[model samples]
Target: MLNNRYEILEQLGRGGFGETFLAIDTRMPSRRKCVIKQLKPDDTTNTAPTPGWFEKRFQREAAILEELGQNNRQIPQLYDYFSEGENFFLVQEWIEGITLSQKHQQEGNLSEAQVEKILRELLPVLDYIHGRGIIHRDIKPDNIILRASDGKPVLIDFGIFKEVNNINGGNKTVPLGTPGYMASEQAAGHPVPSSDLYSLGLTAIFLLTGKTPQALTSDPNTGEILWRKDAPHRPSNLAAVIDRAVRFHPRDRFTSAQEMLTGLPGSAGREKTSVVVPPDTKILPPSRFERWFWVIFIVITGGFSFGFGHPIIKPWLDYLFPNEPTVKELPLIEPSSQINSFVLDEDGQTLVGGDEKGNIYLWEVATGKQKKTIAGQGKAILEIAISNDQQILASSSEDGTIKVWDLKTGKERITLPNQRGLIALALSSDGNTLVTGGKDTTVKLWNLSTGNLIETLPVEKEVVSLAINQDASIIVSGHSGGDISFWQKQGSNPYEPRIFPSINPWTAPSVAVSADGTTAASSSCQENIRIWKDSDWKDSPLQAGSSADICLIVISEDGKIIAGRSSDETIRLWNLNTKKEIFSYSPSSPKSFDSPRMIALSGDGRTVASNFDKKIQVWRPSF
Candidate 1:
């Protein structure tokens, strides 16, 4: 080599900042294979601000690598870093492995479980760097090496690589990371700990989709890459975690690497007792939404029968619905037996019913006779949602799976296997995304057409109830935390949740969003109802004052009216603008209300559907 202490064997690779060669230390008693890097483009007295910033920066990176290599096996050891004439050189341990990019090319797209295992392994490596007050700045598939002997990933090309290429090109020092892998903030000369997270998330997406970051489409307005629509079948849980990490804004990303790790599929709902995560180890636990998600699942499955409507769910239920509906009852259309869940088309013309025996029925509202029946289900169906065009019907059951059916042929289109079993779900207004809450205590967004997981929203609670706005711009969820929270979609920002006001901590709240997406309403177990438009309260809170607890809330598409039920075995209605009660229905009174498992409001805000036990009930309630 240059100094004669090493002998160059072959040229391995070359890049803008330097060239790498395979070499052996001839001076050593036992010759060992090592890597020799030749760094170039020296401008000691010219453009660089630090004057000799390149040399000093190179030395600093060597020290950092040396420390990391000694402590962690995933990093290559730095044996030497020196300057020869105008060129810089670093002799380091040669890692015999395949680059992730190479592996991706050889193996094609990896399975969700395979991608997840990579995340669980490499996130800790990033954590170790970030905790030491250093930012890797660049992370992509090409920069990671999969050791052939162990199959463990080894991180390469750290500090010095960034310092050479990341000049902000301004009066300030901005480090430019590789295109496609760069975080929005890093490009602006402000790289935070979350910056690396963005790159890492993008890398995982590339490995799973086999598409480079540039090939993915990004929303022109938010500048956030729309990878979910492209890789529709990727696991929803992992997608959700990646969505948070790669937000357009750094502040919206995970504050740290360890935080991102806890939200992935394997750790989201796991108990700490089962897996030991050391406090000093620097990895944080799951996000608040994730914890709330599990709690919701536990409370709904372990404590109540009909999810949001069960009176025993929270302390507030014990005192709610203090007085029975005082108005005359509305007209009733009844079903033959107890029904678990049902939906009414936009015109309230068609009724789709789900039963305990795993059968589905489509009935003509005018005739009250079953027009078509789709049979042979495996378990009791818990919830049902119809697409806006009335072309598809999605249903969830006790079997831990979700099925999408074509209305025209009454044939199944897609089947999603969810091991946690689904408890609550809603179809997006556009009918493309299906939002669901599962027994695993996770909230997920699915692409209906391809059965792809669009996002895994870790709400930290199981679902008491879930709702997404008509435009699919916002998601509001009621959790086992005994309150409803609002989640807004921002351009690549971390999901920040705000608590819905006018409710006590011990009350169980049921949330619903208007079809226009302009308004939302919540009916708490305390019999207290509040209305909201956008982010603020629109009207004074209304009370159902049921002689029993109020279980659920459903808002009309027009955002003008709402329908809810009480444990007093009655269905009640109210006008949002008038702030007054519309009417109440006691058609099946004297018989406990436990027979109706679910209820729905028509788009025109005039009709309501209730599944009484097994019988389907469609009624028109007048103000």
Candidate 2:
């Protein structure tokens, strides 16, 4: 009998709920190849009740497919869902790819880079699926297919996926995912984002080690994962991340993909890589307030003469007698010296840095040599800008001043009024316009040629970071409140701002827009960096460590290379195209700190610049 407009060719595979078939759409003489999945009639052995239950399940699956029709590239487009002689069939796009499990069998262990690339491609799809409020409970290797033509991975089989919050009342009661890959919660009946991560982690392990994870048999008294005598052949970081992901308890595993990526080797330093301060360098413990009170009492009892013998008491007494507040300790590095600003020149060839000491240094990207030093202002420099033609360098200083200098002669070309409380600055690609934000709660546009203020766009909060897209048609700014505002020139009201969705609620210290304007990266005060794509923003899959707060974010021209600095004093390189980390560097013994504050990638994506110990150092890949 014809199954709707399709004629059955041969059975492909069968599962508990349904049987999949290779079929042909015969309504047209051409007979296009298609896949049809038909729900099976319930039997005595199976508790999935008869006639009514099968029809309901079939209809539910059809509805899900209908809803997912909009995302056709990631998922097969559903054609038709109907019933024929009590048998319900679903016609869909026939995917052509080898199952991940088949790929594993054909090829040995995959490289860390390959696994990372697969994860990066798969994550965006997962994000889209999860955003629609669906949980793909079964995400084993068998369900993923790698297309031969483009070599892209695709996820198939949504039969076990359940609505994010509707799993409790479902009649499909058995455990959903594969045994070893399933998180304890999924195995015990609760499935969430963490569950999917667990499965993905296990899949990575299978691809990396060429071994299937087996059940753990613990000693009767103590519970632990039982490993064979042989160690798996995988990178230590990859192994550690997977071990944590598949832990017996959900809480023991990485909670998000971001966390897993953060822990991966080269993404963030391992726990052992932390700086160990020598005992001699440790800070002296503070004395208890009670001790101070006792000393004061003793001095009063002795008519203040006893304090002469106590040198510490003498200083304290003098301060107390004077009734003046003690001097506040100045920070070792001036706030302006913090290297909070950066600029990519018109040719993207040179980089210049301005510090709070009012000192400026120019460096050639190729040799990383200091070409010139300009010392004009006495106060700290808060921001820097380079002209599109590479003719001049502009700087904003704490003395409420903005100065423009000739690039060749290092002479002050122009100086604008001091804008007290300067926070961030940006220059248009053509270097014609300069935008500066300060404590005045406004973004000011200036003509770089004349050093004259052009327009003032008032904002509600202090702007923390600023970026201009390639065309200079749109300007994106991040505020202390963790909001990102997009300003466009073509809009009916150019001065009015539109806010992007809040992906992070803490202050984002630095922001970078891709040359193509399709992506944006922001580094936050909370040690996290978020990447915004299309209209929505998602936190980078990479996790930031406690001591390594993300301080800088930079993107390459092709929008493929992304680099960021951590409080851990290291720079991380990410390949967006491959969806894996490429390299990382932790300074040697004498120079390492808790984190690096700023980072920049050259136009060619070959060289990197970062600030440490009051100096900007350049780095290149070992290869």
Candidate 3:
């Protein structure tokens, strides 16, 4: 049906706020294809003139688009915005090509070169967006479309976008963005330039890994991204750039897109134009403050009395106090404490973690000390991950988002959406792809470069644990049903039943794989740690143990050492080649020990670390 002079053709997409349809302009004889976005109304009793609050929001979006049109092709041109019944519709140009999300799904993870190519093109778009003081709060793969003819990424979807300086005065509302890709401040409803960088970093992660940022598990106490499996192979500079852009605190991320683009290999040494902060203006501190101050002054002047008319005392008091009280210098603010997570970058630098609470902490791995706890996040922190270069940090939280931060300047760079509470997260070896698992029960893959959700894998059962193989070819998921499923990269569904039998009636506590991907081991809460040989799955052996249960496990890259932790807080080391116990470590006093929650082994297989009750004990092989 044609609304006014526009002919509606096919529906493009539908979302919570509105619907997008591809249409043609009937007024023009040539019939040009265009896209129309219509806003859906909510229940409201007040029926005033003009438009309702939501309708006004749509009108604001229209105004933004119209303003953007001033810069040649900076944004899609808006043809019209009119009310049809109770719905508001907007029309604009329709560009062709699949979204970056599609590219990540089909390509698994993007290579460093490919990610750079895309980012080079994306940086300019961001520059334009930020130049106008506009922030794309909801930056995700679904919002970016790649032109099929030129492979250029075009960002779309402005329903939740915000203009930093054009806020309405009648109502104050929290800014909204996706969960996994939003910056800490943006998630807290304060939109800034760095928020966009956080989303862009997540987009890059999605491109490097076929998983979403929320799929990787984090240490609850530390708020750090825990990757005991395999680290993605990414260029140090590129990884650091993306990491810094998505730091937890806006202050931890790059201040501008140009700063992010500076780390690109070809763009290195190119200086970003500096922006000078405007001088503070001495203005009235709101009308209420002025009114309250005047009322107090008048009351004091009227109540005061002296022997005659208090002329002498009043003059003395006026001379002492003056007409206005001098503003006292604000006291220095004390920084708040923050929980931190740690990750080893490509160069082995100890990268700290950021949280939504505006806290950033450095991890001194050598001393196991948390240094420099900076107020980074603006709200409660959820998760944090470090890039290979130790220069970038990404954080997410209950605020419904993800953010990228720069470790050097402590600035936030990008923000992305993740409405579903992000629970687990993983980054590929290349640091280009990000995988996230959330309460939604689905594993979402993101293009970390573009802040897009590429592919979503639905696991009918609740996904309790997730691990990606070294080659990024297989994804292993441990469900609540006590079943461990192996998903191949080229399969219809990773959850499809395999010939492997269920080990226990309850979920396994932890799972690990050898670097070669030839051996798979699982530590079960039922007090069993089992291993399966690649060639014969049915011949898997279950390690005999009578402790309360196994809490964690780690397998060496060379398949030589296997470590397991029991709920009784005992560490058992085994020789994979001999299939026998090597040595066991138990505290001198059993009461002093607590169950180990997680374990990890060094590359040489000589060093091992087990965590329990916030303590990480390092062990070395005696032999």
Q: Which candidate gets the maximum lDDT versus the true structure? A: 1
**CA-RMSD of model 1:** 27.3
What lDDT tens digits, residue by residue, belong to model 2 across residues 474-580? 67787886777766665455655777544556555677776556677777656456666745444454444532366677776446667777766677777665545
Best by TM-score: 1
Q: What is the TM-score of each candidate against the true structure?
A: 0.45, 0.42, 0.41
Clashes per candidate, residues 3 or more apart or on different chains: 38, 12, 109
Alpha carbon deviation, residue 492, candidate 1 (Å): 5.4
CA shift of 186, model 1, Å: 65
* Best-to-worst TM-score order: 1, 2, 3
lDDT tens readout by residue for model 1, 172-263: 12445675577533543445567789889899888888878656655544546677766636578788888887765454567567878877
**Could you tell me which 10 consecutive residues in candidate 3 have the lowest summed lDDT?**
324-333
Regions of candidate 1 where Cα sits further than 4 Å from its true position: 1-337, 491-494, 501-507, 535-540, 543-548, 587-589, 612-614
Q: By the TM-score metric, which is better: model 1 or model 3?
A: 1
- Stretches off by above 4 angstroms in model 3 are 45-60, 69-74, 160-172, 219-232, 270-623
